[model samples]
Target: MNRFRFRIRFEDRVGMVRDVAEVVSGHGANILSLEVKPGEMHIQVDQVSPTVLENMLKRVQTIANVLEVTPVEWLPHELAQQRLRAILDTVEEGILVVDARGTVSLCNRKAAEILGLGHSLIGNSLKHLGFPREILTSLGVGRLSQQEILLSTPYGRLRCLVKSQPLVDEEGKPAGAMITFEKMSQVRRLVQSLTQPVMITFEEIIYASQKMAEVVALAKTVAKSDSTILIRGESGTGKELFARAIHMASPRRDNPFVVVNCAAIPDTLLESELFGYANGTFTGALKGGRQGLFEFAHQGTIFLDEIAEIPPYVQAKLLRVLQEGCVRRLGEMLENKVDVRVIAATNRNLEEMVAEGSFREDLFYRLNVIPLYLPPLRERKEDIPALAWHFIQKFNQRLGKNVRSLSEAALRRLYDYDWPGNVRELENVIERAMNLAQGERIEPENIILPEKNLASKSPSGLKRAMEEIERQAVIEALNQGGSVRKAAKILGVSHTTIINKMRRYRISGKTSGQWK
Candidate 1:
C-alpha cells in the first residue's frame, strides 16, 4: 500500500476542505489523515498507487491560491485510479467532463442549469459560449483544474463553483480532465420582494385639496426621472414624507434610502459621513475602510434635507460627485463609483441665497432640475378638514383615545384661523384639542386658534398685498384698452396691452358698471 500526502492553499475560507476532500476521495486514495493550517494545509492519503500519484498532484495544484504540491506515496496504482474517477463522478455538484482537447464530455444536471443549456452540452466547446476564455483554455492544456468562473447564458449571469481534476494515462501523465460545478445560491425571493416592493401612488399621498393634488402630481413627474429635485416648503409640510414617497416611486427604490439632515449634523462630521475614509485614514478610522453614505447608498436614493444649510465647501464636493458620478473618500485616492438619486428639501429660499452669494448658482441649477413647491396650509385651506380628520385618527390610534371627529363650530374655527406653521401646526392643535375634549367630538374650546391679532396680521397683510397688486394691474389694463392708442399712449404701454387689459379686468370704460 502506497500513501500520498498533498498540501494545498485556498484563496477564501468557505468550504475549501470539504471540496478538497471530495476531490481526494474521488481519486480512490483512502485518507490516512488530513491537517489544516492558516494559508497552508497538508493532506495525507493511504492506498494511492505510485502510477496515479503524479496525476493527483497536478490536479490539486490547479486550485487557485495553491502554493505547492509534494507527492509522498504508499499505495497500489490501479485501485487508486478507479477510486478517484468514481469519487469525481459521484460528486453532488454538477460536473463538466472534458477531454484534453477541451471538448465537453459529460455534465451533471446542475451544470446544465448553470450554463442555461440543456443536458445536451456533451459535444460543445466552452469557448463557443460566454464562459471566460482563460478558464476554458486552461482546462484544455491541463494546467488548471478549479477556477471560479462567470458564465452568461439565456437564463442570466451565473456564478459557478468550479473544481477540476485530470484524467491520467497508464504512464501517469495527464490525459483528460473533469470539472465539477456548484451553482451559487441566490438570496430568497421574499427578501428581494421586501427590499423592493411596489410604489405608493400619488393618490396615496393623503391630501384632498387641489393644491395638494397638484403637489402630488408634480412629485410624480419628479419621481419619473433621475434628476435632482428640490422640494421647498415649511416645516411640518411633510417635506421628508414626500421625499420618501418620491424615492419609493423612483427607479432607485431597490437600493437604500439614506437621509442626511444638513441642519441636524455638525459641519465638521457631515463631510466624512457623506464620504467614508480609508483604514487608518484618520484617528478613529474603522478596520479596512468605512463606506460613506454614497457608497452605502449605491444604486439608491439620498435625501438631503435642509440642503440650504450645507456648507460651501461641502457643496462643492457634492457638486463634483454629482457631475463625475464618483465619490472620493476623505483620506483615500481611490474614487468609488456610485449611482444615487438625490432629493433635496429646504424651508429657505435657495434663489435668494444664490443672489446673496450664500449659495452657488451652478449647484443651485443642478439641484433645481425638478422643483416642487408645497403650498403652505393657508392657501390649501380646502384640505384642512380632511387633513385634520386624518391626524385625529392617527393620534386617536396612538394615544388609545376614541375620539371620532370634530364639532361643526370647531371645524369652522380650524378653517377660519390662519395656520402659521401650516399642516404641522394644524396637527398640533388637533392633538391638543383631542386631549382636552371630554367627549368623542372635539369642540371649539378644545381647539385653540392662533391669537386673533397674530392671525389677522398675516391673513390681512396677504389679502391687502394681493388685492393691491390685482387692483393696480386691472387699472393699467383698462387704461390701455380705452385709447387703444391714447390710453396706451398715456400709460406708456402698447396698444395690444390696452385690449388685453380690458379683457382681463372685465371693464369697458364707457359702461356705467365700469365707471362705478
Candidate 2:
C-alpha cells in the first residue's frame, strides 16, 4: 500500500500532461493529488503498486521526459486490493488471479469470454478451464511464466495467450500467481488479409514501351478504385492483358479473376454461359443447375474479352447485370444478388458500332467508367528493337538454339518495315527468323519481306535484255566466291560498290555459278 510521487515533463509543456494522465489511467492508477509546475507536474497516488508505477513511468518517459519517481505509503492492503480490482474490472482486457495452488482466486467477465467460460471460474482449478495441468503446476512452482494456448469451446476454437506472474511474500518466496489472456484468432485473420496473393498484377504483364508504361500506370490507378474499366485496342495489342492487370491490382485481387471470350463463343451459348440457367432450363442443364461466371465470380472480378462481339440480346442481359448488380437464370423468376467487378476489352470500335446503331449506348457508358486506350505497334516503333530482342530470347529458349542475338543490319530492316499486326506480328517474324537461322546471329536472309511491285527499268529495249544478262553473270560470279569481299575482288570492283550492286540485283544463290 504505497503511494508514488512522480514528476513528469513534456516537451513544450503542450500535451505531455494529458498523455501522462492517460498512461497512468490505462494502467489502473488513481491520481490522488496533482499540481502543475512550470514545465512539469508533481503527481501523488495511493494504491499503485511498483509494477503499475513502472509501466506508467515507462510510457510517460517515451513521450518527452520524466523527472523523478518516489514512493509514499498511503492505503493499506484491503482497501488497495478493492480499488485495484474495481479499476481492472473496467478494462477491456481479460483479467484473472490464480493462487499458488493453481486455483482461480478471481475472474472478470472479459476473462471468462476470452477463455470460453464464465467468471464462475473463481474457486475452480484453472486446469479445468483448459490451462494444461503441467503448465499450471509449473506456474505455481515459478518455473513457467507465460505461454500461448488454443482453447476449444461450444462457440468455436479460440486462440488464447496467457501471461503469468508469481506473487512473492515478504520472505521473497513464491506464494500466488496471476494470468492474463486475450483472444488470438482476430489477429491471425488480419495478418492473412494483409499477406494474401494477388491473382493478376501489373508486373505480370511485360512491356518496355512508353505507351505501355503509360497504360499500366493508368490501370494501376484505376484498379485501386471501384470503377468499371473498358480496354480498347487492336486484337493483338494486349487489351486483355491490360484488363487482367487492372483486376489484379484492385482490392478484389484476392478473389477470383474469371475470363470470358465473347468472340470465341456463339451468341446462342454466350447468354446461358454468362448468366447461369435454372434447373431444367435447357437440354444439357446440370442436375441442380449451374452458377454463371458472374455468380461464381461474386465478390471478385470478371474479364470480358472481345466484349464488342457480344450479341444484342446478350448485351441487354449484360447491361442488366452491370446496372442491377443481380442475375436471373434463363427460366428463373427470382434474381440473385451478386458483387462482381467488370473489366471489358475489345479490338472493335464500340463508338462506331454505337454510331451504326449496332451496340447499346447505355451499356457502353456503363462499362466505360474508365477507358484505357492502347497504341498499335507501328505507332510505337521505338519499342520494336526491345520487343524484337525479347522475342528472340523467348524463341531461342523454345528452339534450344545457340541464337545469341539479331544482327544490327537485320534489326534495322525489321524496324523499317510496318508491322500491320503489332506485337503479334513482330513475334511471328522473330519466330520465323529463328527457324531459318543456322548460327547464333540472325542474318537479313533469315527475314522474308513482302514483294513490292514496280514498272520494269527498261520497258521496250534490246539493251534491257543485255543488261539483265550482265547482271546474271555478276551474281553468278559472287555466288562462286560466297563471300562479298571475295566476290568484289573476283568481279574487279571495290567491295562496297560491289555489295551495293549485288543488293540491287537481289542476288542470292539459286543458279549458284551460272550465267545465261
* TM-score of each prediction: 0.54, 0.50
Lowest summed lDDT window (length 10), candidate 2: 451-460
Q: Give the alpha carbon lDDT tens digit for every residue of 203-240 in model 1.
A: 55678887788789888877878888999998778888
| Model 1 worst lDDT window (10 residues) | 184-193
> On residues 10-68, what C-alpha lDDT tens digit does candidate 2 reach at each position?
44556666877888888888988776767656777768777877787777777655554
Candidate whose TM-score is highest: 1
Task: After superposing candidate 1 on the true structure, give the runs of residues whose Cα lies further than 4 Å from its correct spot.
Answer: 1-201, 452-516
TM-score of 2: 0.50
